[model samples]
Target chain A: MEKVDCIIVGGGLAGLSAAYGLASEGLEVMVVERGDYSGAKNVTGGRLYLSPIRDIYPELWESAPFERPVTRELVTLMGDGASTTIELASDRFATAPHQSYTVLRARLDQWLADQVMEKGGMVITKNRVDEILMEGDKVIGIRAGGDDIGADVTIIAEGVLGLLSSKVGLREQPTARDHALGYKEILELPSSVIQDRWHLNEGEGAAHLFMGEVTKGMMGGGFLYTNKDSISLGIVVGMEAMRERTEKVESHTLLDAFKELPHIRPLVEGGTLVEYSAHAIPEGGIAKVPKLFGDGYLMVGDAAGLALNALLTVRGMDFAIASGFYAARAVADAKNRGDCSAAGLAQYEQSLRSSFVLKDLETAKEIPHIMENPRLFTHYPQAVSGLLEKLYTIGPHPSQKLSSTVIGGVRKDFMNARTLKELLAMRKI
Target chain B: MDIVVSVKTNLDLQMIRIKNREPVLEAIPYKTGDLDKNAVEAALQLRDAVGESKVIVLTVAESNRKVRETIKEVLAMGADEAVLIVDPALESTDQAGVARTLAAALQKIGSYDLVLFGEGSSDDYSGQVGPRVAELLGVPQIGYARQITAGGAGVLVERSMDEYIETLEAPLPAVLTVVSEINEPRIPSLMNIMKAGKKPTEEWSLADLGLDPAAVASSCETLSNLAEEQDRKHIMLEGGAAEQAAGLVNALLKEGIVGR
Candidate 1:
């Protein structure tokens, strides 16, 4: 049997990050993937945030198989028939050391996996690791395909829904409490139409977030992002929240509701859906993260419950990449010291904590509960939309001032004191 | 010269829908398991290569009777015989135990030049039964086969691996588990369906095989419940076509994909 310094169990962003980092240091690594290839099973919200990548892969945008760069961001507060949207554009994002770029996980991860192989790491696709091989409570290797592959250390980068972390007694069996399921569709549109619609130059893009009746009053939000000549559109809902609501809902039913929303309809009017998919995310925030270090093993990315700052918008890929980078660094350090024990691997957890991954996760832990309040997700968007409708409409009747329209909308949904509290509470969280 | 291909009716995953939080697999239509697809394809291919008189279809799920109707459909594809291995006690057996009962029937059939199976069943995905059956029958086995070609006193097969492929030859009467890409299965013609009715079908009961139900019953895995993951919700983007395009681009950027 060929022995390796490290074995990674997944081929997502985190796994690839670790692989790239370890291989760059000249360590023998193997990535066991369950997909047809690196990205066959990966689904993302369609962005690659740049802050994390600037230090590791500064010039990756030109070399990477990215779709486009986004220079605009839109937050839409929508109701049944009207919406108030805030669009923010930054010319500063247009230059290199770019702000953010859109990437297809399939293309990006495949490229990253190739780079790892290019650096002499072995990537084995179509193999599912069934169990972690242990020696007296220490993870020594992995068992897959009725064959055992021995390694000095193992990094469990398995995706969020994988049960292997719990199987080896490292993490508790996941519950609906800490997770949400997201369903996405990739629609194909002409590149010219995309640029014309989004008002972008050849390579620029924009992203939008929607609230209120689009979800039909559920506790989740919708998103749409532009690609080269296609769009990534989807909805993500809290699992526990959905369970509490007494509604018979299916993803397709919710999809139809989103499509028929007056504020959402024309955006995707003539596009053709090319791919439809469903995936789950760890939404339990910082509190639900499992044991990050154990006997000769470690978990990172979604498996470790390191998702993103939830209320700021769904962000996981960047966190996944950053976590993977740190995990690989730890493995490299442990190798340098010639110790692959749990104590040696604990460096990974420490470094991750000291890094932005943990600091941000810890701070944003309370955001989910704050966002869980239905009034914030519903009445806030409804109130904004109602106010906008009154301000924009030109009617034959006596016109009301914009201030009166805002006050009237707030009074319809909340009393003056309650409106102030809601705004303040939202700002504080 | 008769061939027996074992098949089971399983839940059609494509049509299965969850209503009231219960997976209605039974309510959904049934389809032949992946193994049976390869078995039928193998039988049809052999029938064309050797002669039609020697090909047969064998299944262990005859008690359902609906299963027999399915077997007829297989015969319609080209099998010269249709046999059903039916026994009330055989229901709900695990992979290892199912292999045991199958080994018993294969032994009673006496001898054959070859026996083929798909790499594994779809539901269990155990990928164990073929090798386990070969062990029981005292025959050499080759698995993960992407291509098979007849050879002297044995067969030559190409085993597909993750990156590399290997080809090996095993003696005649050996067992082989084939892969999906081996061949495109054929559909039964109208004439073949009419002819299948006249074909021979050997129906076997548990008593005929001299099997004790008590021995096999103990090996079955217990089933308590079946559940499915809940579906997600929809969050549509806003601001007409231009806004929608801008929204997508912005999401990608927020995801940290675009600029720096």
Candidate 2:
């Protein structure tokens, strides 16, 4: 049997971050990944908010492979044939330690795994960890390929599926309501074209999110993040709603409709589809988070359901990094005390409760429920677009007061007191 | 019996990106050649059958980060040890140069009873390395072996030659190239992967093997490498299902791709 100070069961951001932290402190750690490499199996909407992870690896962006610093943010509400957009751009976003950057997980995760190895950690790829070895209810190691390897501590950082965590009873199997299916395509274009289309300067990028009919009234949205020489565009739809969708409304059909939208087509015109991928996202928020730590074991990243979908910004990678960092700290503390028990490992949850990871999720816990309302996906965006159109159209004989036009549009949608209250609640997030 | 398997780290063709009709090869990720892994599996199988043998993996490539990762993968696949010849001068080495460098490393080790090579590399299908190495080492060589069995102090191999299969025997101390159908490679377990890091991997250069770089210079030179731009006529056949079917059949028949 082989022994290590720590065994990490996935090489995603969370696992690699924990491995990096443990290895940097002179702990022997091994990260076993089932993919050909760390990021080989990961997919994301392509923008990573780096503020939360700046402290994890202070110099991360200095050496990491980032597509571009995002200087522009655009959010659009799409109606049947029209849309309303809010665009924000700032020069401050282009500086070092910038707000966020666009990245392809395949390159970023591999770079992080390399960093872990360079920090004296070991990473083994193309190997699946079949099961966690236990000693009287304590996770002692992992069994992979019919071989038993022992470790002082084990961390499961598997992504949204959380297969290992569920198998080990850390959490129940996620249902359709708790997960979302995201399909993304990487479109190849010239760097100059991306800059021109997104109104970005050299080395600057944009993140654009689309709500409303882009999802074909499904409870989901479309996203586009600018890479250096390509565009990452995709749609994310809730599985609960997707399951109830008629067979004629397939997920790819939704993506195809989104691509043909008047506001989205010109941006991706003449681009080659280089790659397409689909992945599951854990959208269950803090309410669905499982028990984070146990005897000789810890769960981080999506395995712990540590993702937040705040409508304007959907984030997981940052949360994964933060959780990984906190989990490693707790594990290191436990090791220093020579206690690898459930009581000792409980500090991880404590750290998370006090940290931004859980706090942010707690604050946005209601966003998922609010987003689940079908009218929010179908009625609200169209009403808003109708109100804007009434305000903008300059017909010769119909010059009504702006307030009356707005009131008329709202009344047209049958926005009564209850609907107004619901809209207010939805806006609170 | 001791066996040495020669593997090559080639660019993952699937991951290759074509830009402006040119392949962006510099930063593309590389993996151990797919069929070369079969050769490694064959060598490991021979060792398993012989009961007391070692599988030494050998590769000649530039000493870079990508090559190091590739070498680790080969080691994890059950190679007892590895000999890596990573030198800047060999970055563009041709088949002949690679064969010479490998032959020199084998000669330096000096005790291998058999050597294994893939019939051809995935990136460059020049199936000359094994035979050229044998010629340089002055050893008998067998090419395109689909199945191999160990006999007394020797091995017998089954090979396909054009339209016929032939069985041949080679005494100890010979070279053999294997086809992809030889055997399925095994994925290393987590424990074995951990142990692979501790396995002895010795790095050598051309000078370390007491060979002059000038004598092993590449003979073949690549003039131009470009992605083949395929001009596809994406003509959409329209109308009802039966009409479209008849139109497709008519098109194929016009192109002589279907029955008359």
lDDT of candidate model 1 versus the reference: 0.76
Off by over 4 Å in 2: A1-3, A134-136, A243-248, A403-416, A423-428, B17-21, B24-28, B48-53, B146-172, B181-184, B210-217, B227-260
Looking at candidate 2, what is the lDDT of residue A388? 93
Provide the lowest-lDDT 10-residue window in model 2 chain A: A88-97
Measured against the true two-chain complex, the DockQ scores of the candidates, in the order shown, are 0.01, 0.57
Cα lDDT of model 2 by residue, A242-284, tens digit: 8887854778988888788776799999999988999999988
Clashing pairs in 2: none
Collision count of model 1: 32
Docking class of 1: incorrect
Model 1 C-alpha lDDT per residue in residues A152-179, reported as the tens digit of each score: 8899999897588687688888888678
Error of 1 at A80 (Å): 2.2
